[model samples]
Target: MTRCDWAENANELMTRYHDYEWGVPTTDERETFELMTLEMMQAGLSWQTVLNKRANFKVAFADFDVTKVARFDDNDVVRLLNDAGIIRNRLKIKDTIHNARQLGKWHAAGKTMNAYLWAFVDGQPIVNRYLSMVEVPAQTPLSQQISKALKKAGFKFVGPTIVQSWLEALGILDDHLATCTVNHLSK
Candidate 1:
């Protein structure tokens, strides 16, 4: 089956992620938070690296439970920094904790990450018809707007490029190549 060119030569884990998870729409708050965290962790690193250490991240971040992670203290930060299984970036680690607290505040206000994000696209994925990976952009105007909103909302490490990737990863933006078999929009 034809896959996106980037995923074609990837390792088994990445291949599976491409086929099964990437660009799949999800409204689950936990899953949304987890994807956002993973995207943030991927800054200055490869997605493959993040995927390689995903299990460790899940364990380290309390399965991406917003409340649990928001409660992570200085001791937890130190533990994450010294953990060999995940990325040891202090900024990303602390940012994850801070972002969790922001999410917690949103939760208290009866807002959900899923709803906040999907609202950008009117609750539907923006299906793109690019014929090749080259046609896919690194960041778009929409991403920039979203990044600005997120930053204003107190999220860190969420620049436009990262926000764009996170949007794509969450299926808010479906960027699968039109020629690829996994392009559900094409089908």
Candidate 2:
């Protein structure tokens, strides 16, 4: 079977995420929150690592429920550190809760996460036809703009690299390989 150019490994998890979730536009506030949190957990780590621990991350993160995660306390942080299924980094774990709180703040400001996020692309995906894996970019001006806005909103772990990946995953940007079917399909 074929896949997106970025998929160097066609393992089960990668394949599933690529086929079903990657590059698919998601407007759900909860999902955007989850992706943001996961991207933070992925810092100094591999996407595959996060994917392998995804189930555990979901459980530890309370199924990516924004309200519940935003309310997590110090005790909750300790509980997460002891959990074997997810990454144990204290800062990254704490950032998850921090991001959730920011999400709530955005909502209170009358801007849903989905709306605020998708607005950077003007409610359309930035489709790129990369001929090879190396041809795809790590960051774009749009991602930079969003990253700046996210930081201003008091969100942590939203650097340019993470923001760019998040946008691609959320389908705000499509970096599918030009030869890949989805590249032409999305256009």
TM-score for all models, in order of appearance = 0.96, 0.93
Per-residue lDDT for 11 in model 2? 81
* Candidate 2 minimal-lDDT segment of 10 residues: 178-187
Please provide, for model 1 over 1-187, each residue's C-alpha lDDT reduced to its tens digit, 9 standing for 90 to 100. 8999889989998888888778888888998999999999999889999999999999999999999999999999999999999999999999999999999999999999999999999998998979889889999999999999999989999999999999999889988888778644311
What lDDT is reached at residue 130 by model 1?
A: 94
Candidate 1 clash pair list: none
* Model 2 per-residue lDDT tens digits across residues 86-132: 99999898888888888877776787988888777789888887778
- Give the TM-score comparing model 1 with the true structure, all chains together: 0.96
Model 2 global lDDT (CA atoms, 0 to 1):
0.83
Off by over 4 Å in 2: 182-187
- The residue pairs found clashing in candidate 2 are none
